[model samples]
Target: MGKRDVDDDDDDDGGKRRKASGGFSDHAPPDDGQSAEIQLDQMLAGGAGLAGLGMGMPGMGMPGMGMPGMGMPTPGLSVPGASAAPELDPLKPATTPMDFSKLGANMPSQEFPVPRDMVEYLMTPEHRQILLEETGCDVDWAPDESKVQLKGSAEQIRKAQRLLQRVLMHCNWGRSEAKVRRLLKPKIIESAVLRLSPMNTLPAGQKTLSQTQPVISIGKDKKANDIVIPAAIVSRQHCVLELDIDRGAIYVIDCSTNGTFLNGLRLPPKTTGKVLVSHGDELLLQDPANDQEFGYVVNIQELNVREQTKLQAPRRLLSTEESATMGRDFQ
Candidate 1:
């Protein structure tokens, strides 16, 4: 997550490139397999240091990834490299297929189903009120978990999480003493606290969308077209925008009566669908129901800066500029 500060070395071909520093050159070419070992060591050292600082390793049940058992493994801890031994592939097909179903069949059944009641209790009005107070949500009652549904873009999900956290805090405070005490047991509280702690969400030195308005224009166009949307439609329906960090791609979702269009092509109208928008490209959203049109354009220079900064140094070191140029061109 930390960027290496290295000098950009000029190539014989008059191209500019950066070298990988911060003691990472040991993993340079001719050591493809060895690089993994070096990286593993680095990760272990980093993880241990972080642990000493009271910061869990990337995957070690840390927040900003996801809560444990919520699906994803802790960020950096569960990676394949963390294991002492590397996994090996079988040389030939197994002589007999393994049966996993029978292994679980004899497992003892629980007297009661996994604690659905406890989960419900955690989301009760009193608990939610406590969470809300902690998370800064102004609400009369905790959110209804049963009715809570995540929708729209990733940004929307984040907003929802903020709201939910507040509700959770509020609920926590107002719950019955027994229930509150049970949910806030030391281990549970610690786990929750660690999971909710703030982190550096964006890459260091990177500018956020709010910091600047990225001007987008079509190919070879100096003057970009204006992106417009009627206030009525924006207010009534969800508008989601997705930016693909790796591809430098942008997608706009039209969840309104008006359909989204790029150039002259009509984009699909759905709550969830993707439309590619490149730098300087014109985006138009038309709503037949309301007779409205919205237009938007991209900024190419900013996109180029982003693309340049995103280029992986390891890949650049291992290959020539021509090769890298070809890869990007094709992509």
Candidate 2:
């Protein structure tokens, strides 16, 4: 090649090499590299939010990795996939309760211990009506009130027994100390309700779990849930309510594709974890941004008159230090 052509070729190669290195230091010192990694490890130590990491870095804005509350999913939360719910199987039962029994089910007769102290409850018109009509049991309480003999089919007897047990449990018959038990009376029924407000096609009403009904499933599919809310946004098995009578509490679990909201908080869909619910907490069966969902207003009957009074009792404001400490504790 001519001298000029060779000179041009060498100049081009030099420029290419310089550009490949980006005109900066091509290698970091071993110590400097280690220090940079340590700093990065510290930043990711919590594995929650990438604190102190500027957004200028590529991919730093990823959900659950970048700064929290920036459209980021919470750490450890399973971001729901953009997929449709599974189709309902045509062979499944039409209603949740029907899955357990066929039409017109009746069990053999049975006996159970129904405390005499709560016998007055059985005689109450409302309870009596339920026992006779629902369970088909005429519960004959022992004269001493130690036990009961329910004259009905087995299913009927079980139903009656469960009803009475709930009452006993509510009254703290076995849950309380002997002295407290004797002092307690069946005066107040510690209860709560999910009052479904009328909207779209849903009717106005309330659902109270009693007479042995502890858990009820909600959804649009008739075969899988006891409480069927026919909303286009509702999933086949939307959510579940677990009522704990002894503790006077209710737990809610969301298992929907759209969402289930409790007190304006969207519960993690399909999560096994349940949120403790109290009175006045609102549960929405659809995305809060949507207006077609039903809102169930929780109405928890006060557990105790003394506790109620204490809740309503006034209190002086805390000092600044105490307030700060309380805030930190909640955080």
Candidate 3:
């Protein structure tokens, strides 16, 4: 009886399995029907919006991140009517403010005569702007167009003047504009000499200072002086001459009861008033009306001329009658 039961159960299970297998063979089950290409297209379609949002690719960063040089738009959502990014102009010069640390302070205000040839080059707006901005100096062209007035502290003025000097020299040498701009720096005058010559007959015992002397004094005082000319017209403490070795320039300051004249023009009194004496300029001791009274011809020689060794020794050549007549005033 047990064998009989076992055989029946096996037969029933086998019949059920065969029936299930035959059902499936008649019609195939549903597949994951999407093909590779179709799946790829779906993914790309979703990524299209993300690409515009800069999210689909690596290193895209967040949308509207606006990181520097990141190729992203400004930091905000794009508006429908917003204007496009401005195109950079190619012709405009990029402005970088000048550094003022190098230009020191307390530069004295001064005026400079622009050489005739450099008037045009130095007067341009571009160069003038550079002077004002870089040197902290206010530069203006004189109405006559012959000079430029610089107003600033002494240090600034000196720097500006040096720049002008370099520019002018380079211009005379036919240097390019670019080259002139590159050669700017502080400069010093190596050596200098002042030559003074009497414009008229002097007293028999009168003497003038040597030209090689860095400084000279002129006055009516006969004792304790460098250049002594005994005349009633000149004040006891009339004027003095000074040499600026570093600047290669000569300055004449008037200190007189009467007056000190430059090229027949009266100079201002005391140190407050001074004039830069140029080569072959005259220093008249008295008024222009004093026809017979003498003055001095001032000649300033700089390092360039000094290098040539053409400087002459101080000498006085006078007639016998003039020498005899000169000592009468002192007596």
Candidate 4:
């Protein structure tokens, strides 16, 4: 057959027909490769044939392309144009303020006055001497003046106070208000808690005082020979025993030993541990079979070399008395 005639016969058998100009054929096209290509092209041109290919309407611009909302759901993300979920406020309070006058009357006030005896005890003669030297005051100057003024200007006072504070810290009285004020004009809570615990020494053995390092024995019996190291210790241990001498709370560590024990309890030997070595607390050494009693006496006067230094330092104050004094002096 001729080319044109042969093409016409093929179209008739396949149920296909060419488009008239730019428009689609009115009759349904046969399900063939060429028909599919024509349908895709029509969809890309913003036609309505994409629904037959299981796709929604094609978006404009690129050919045969579909956007997010063009029928298929996104793999893991929420749909576009969706409302955002509300978040809960974590900082909102559960209850509102209410009258608690009856409850308030039952609760005691928390205010505590600084004890006069405690204050006096902290400010000793040695401490006064140290402050005088630091402030460049007369050797015989007394700390009991109504207002002890510095010789120089305000800057000088501040400098002197800072120096005095350093001296007080050296003496180990950084916590004392009088000492802190003499050193730094404004005292702080941190300074108040900076006082170091006094060092103490146990009585030396008969062998030789020089050979025996001063040891502080905790427990009731001062003469108890046996002592317990609560934490485990190894061959060479370098550990410290920090204790609040006033409150009798002790923290011990075993640098390296198989272990330390307290009252026959097997404590982890090489780790840091805290135990209340109060009056009558028993300390027993496990390996050596030595034992010692804790808390012989809470001697506040038995100041160690380090504690003595702290006590001899000037007290710190929260504010400078200079301004008040200046106002009074000029007025």
Candidate 5:
């Protein structure tokens, strides 16, 4: 037979078997080599179909195995673009600092000890207002009124403390209300001496007994006054130089016909009580008779020393036994 006639006869026989069976099946077993070749072809075709759909077997760079640009979801896994889950570490305890400031937590209060005399001054409305405006903090007084507690941030509390320190430093100088309010600088005086000088020429230092008062009077009378200016324009008690040993302050009381000019500012007679005389301050004796604008000028100098002497020596009352012994010794 011809090749075409033989192929037609095989096809007719396979079609008649398929009609009787009603489905595809092996009409008869092929040779071992042909069957093996057909199985190999089927596997290759299945693998190619899977690769085109962007899927593959395990460990073969599959799309679900995080291969480049394939973006397939894996089982039991969360997709991207979601909140990150927290990871807890089992080896170490958390040591993060808690922020209590935002929770309205109260911090430890800071207290500043103040002098008893200075408590009222520091608590004044003006000073308190200054503290609040500058430091953004307020203070509370202790029961004994000896110290103040400030509540705020660390920087604010520190600023408030410094303000108090400055107030103390200035207030320690002179406890006078006017002086403390002005916040004047303290004068570290060792030995303050007061004496009278002439209107024309200032006198040098004079020798005086220690028993006399630290004050030296100035006037027309040479015998009555500690030092005298013989000019007719001077008064009998023109002015008195007082040395305040306790306060470390010097003052001049004007009782003259014209007035006392301290630093060219007049302390008019019977009008102003007294004026402070600090180091480098000028004490001028105004002469009403003369039409001159200026007057007698005296320069004050605070003597420098290694140590300051006590303002007043200590004193004690004599006991009965000590008095009796002293009386017997005198007799």
Candidate 6:
């Protein structure tokens, strides 16, 4: 009986041991052959399990390799961000300077020097109209002055240049007593020549009046009047002869201290009015106290023969078509 009891006690103890082992195995993680707590304890104790971090391991970067300049470097692999970028301190300065020497000081200018007289002549509306008609180009003086600024096509510019050359060829001879006056006899809308016997002792003296020369002051004052009669009876600014292009009529205004007689009618001096004059009218710039045949006779000519000039009424005028005619004349 004693032998039997001892054998039963040993059987119970073995069963209890097997049951505890079964409970432990049921709660264990399948991934790790060891329990997590045991492995954590072994890692903390620096056992072989610490090798999982790959410290000092070959071909492993960062974690396995050592840090640069910290007594640690990656095994057979370079550290990133170190010596990757090129040196930014440039070997030479990046700068460019203007080479003004390339701008040759000896280059010829495209602009031609225009005389001041020619510039003034070309700038006038009358001459500009002529230029437009002849060359179909618009021209102006440069702000720099005395430079012709022509605006047009190349062909038109050439034509303008030719016309300018012709004018320049004669402009120099304007004052000289040359017979080249008939070279370019521009058509006049309405113009007149004043004929007068200076003092009944001399032949008839004449003065041409056109749009360009619309007003002519006749008196003894050489500086004030265009036609200086130098007569003892005449005043400084005795009378003015004005041509009306729009009206195609001419007027005579008396500015003389001595009475001026127009067809025997005395005109009010310095008045704001003008007297209409015709081809046959007469002007006596002397006091009525003395009778004199020495006076002016108006001779108005319509070079534009088509537009008949009416002395009685103001008539609207138009530019007549340019007629090519040649004759010797004076400026």
TM-score of each: 0.22, 0.32, 0.39, 0.20, 0.35, 0.34
Off by over 4 Å in 2: 1-193, 199-201, 302-331
Top model number, lDDT: 3
What is the TM-score (0 to 1) of candidate 5?
A: 0.35
Candidate 4: where are CA atoms >4 Å away?
1-119, 122-129, 137-226, 229-294, 298-331
Model 6 earns a TM-score of: 0.34
lDDT for 281 in candidate 2 is 61
C-alpha lDDT of residue 92 in model 4: 75
Model 1, 1-331: lDDT tens digits are 5765677678898876755543234335344455544664665677643343233434343343243532234444543334444545688654677778755343322111112333555445664454344333322322333343333344434443544433243232133444333222211110000001112221111122312332221111223222222344342433334443443434444444545555555555442234543334544445423332344443322323231221122223224553322222111
Better of 1 and 2 by lDDT: 2
Give residue 331's lDDT in candidate 3 (0 to 100): 5
Model 4 lDDT per residue over 15-65, tens place? 664544222334456566466456656654664443433333333222333
Which is better, 3 or 4, measured by lDDT?
3
How does each model score on lDDT?
A: 0.36, 0.51, 0.55, 0.33, 0.52, 0.53
Candidate 3, residues 1-331, lDDT tens digits: the string is 3333122223644643222321122333337776534643564466533344334344545333233233344443342455777666899987789989856445456788877666655576766777776677888887466898898877778767767765664344233434333333212334455567676685322222233555677776867457776778777867877653533345577777887777666775553334555556667777878663468776655553232111111224545664432211000
Per-residue alpha-carbon lDDT of model 6 for 1-331, expressed as tens digits? Answer: 2343122223644643222221122243446588655754564466432134343344433332233333244344333344543436677776678789855344322344567755545455665565566666666657357877676666667666665554555344231212112122233247666565444553355667677877777888889887777788888888887765654546667777776877666764444345555555667777545875657665665454233321221223322321111111111
Per-residue alpha-carbon lDDT of model 2 for 1-331, expressed as tens digits?
4343122223644643222221112333355455544654554574523334443344445444343454454344333452444568899966654465543345354667765665554444554554566456776556465666677666666666655554454343122332122112222234445555544456454566643765667788889887687878888988877664543445577778887887666774332245555455667777667663466765654333212110111234556664432211000
Candidate 3's error at 194, in angstroms? 1.5
RMSD to truth, every model: 38.2, 33.6, 17.9, 24.9, 18.3, 23.1
Q: What lDDT, from 0 to 1, does candidate 1 have?
A: 0.36
For candidate 3, which ten residues in a row score worst on lDDT? 306-315
